[model samples]
Target: MKKLFIAALLFVGMVSFAQDAAQPVKQQRERLTPEQRNEKHLKKLTTELNLDTNQQAQVAKLLADRSAKAQKHMEMRKARKDSSIKPTAEEKAALKKEIMDEKTATEAQMKSILNAEQYKKWTAMRDENKEKMKDKMKERKNKL
Candidate 1:
């Protein structure tokens, strides 16, 4: 009777091990093309902002351009990492300044494209996301 109970416990342990081993690993999301990304952004904005056809067209164009620029910037950054050349303080500052300029330009374009109410909502959303990102970074830093 003791031998039989020991055998049952061993069998249960093996079954649990097999079940755990069979579970699939979580996969990251597949990368999207710039145009597809822009389209996705447009859809989200349209849903949130209730954009009209003309506004949609303008926003689509702006999003596509923004996405393209962002993709290029990321590729450039990756290339810089591959080259093993570390940026100096001045270079880092310049890059940051350029990013800020681009952001300011984008915000201006958005304001021109959207009505006052829509722009206000969009800014609010942007601010909220920025805060969330800051919190996430702070948490990550604390973890480190």
Candidate 2:
């Protein structure tokens, strides 16, 4: 009787451990890198806005440009992270302004590719995705 009881307890414990292990795997699968997020947003926009081939090509170019700029900014920031070397407020502001300008340019180019109605839908989709990304990041931070 004791042997059977022990076996049952062990089986239950194993099942619970398996379930705990599975949860994080599921969560990790849902997590997106910056590139993945961009691709997903583009895909959603394309589907919802019914982009033509020309629009799709233009959007792709915009995405590539944005990604390159973002990567460069990240690299620059990483290079500036030495404890003894800090950016001045002016320098930081300048960098931020540059990034914002690049973003505005990209958005303008995208707008040119899309019709007014499509642009509106695209903007709405982009806003919704920004919120979703914020929520996902919050969830990841909570997990950490």
> Candidate 1: where are CA atoms >4 Å away?
1-24, 142-144
Please list the C-alpha lDDT of all candidates, in the order they appear. Answer: 0.75, 0.69
Q: How displaced is residue 136 in candidate 2, in Å?
A: 5.2
Question: Which ten contiguous residues of candidate 1 have the minimum total lDDT?
Answer: 1-10
Per residue, candidate 2 scores C-alpha lDDT tens digits across 1-144 of 112233344455446556675554322245566678668867876899998888887887777667676667656666787555799999988977886787688778878999999989878977886787567556645654
lDDT of 2: 0.69
Highest lDDT, which number?
A: 1
Quantify how close model 2 is to the true structure by its C-alpha RMSD in Å: 14.0
Which one wins on TM-score? 1
Global lDDT for candidate 1?
0.75
Error of 1 at 144 (Å): 4.6
Which ranges in model 2 have alpha carbons more than 4 Å from their true place? 1-27, 30-41, 82-84, 133-144
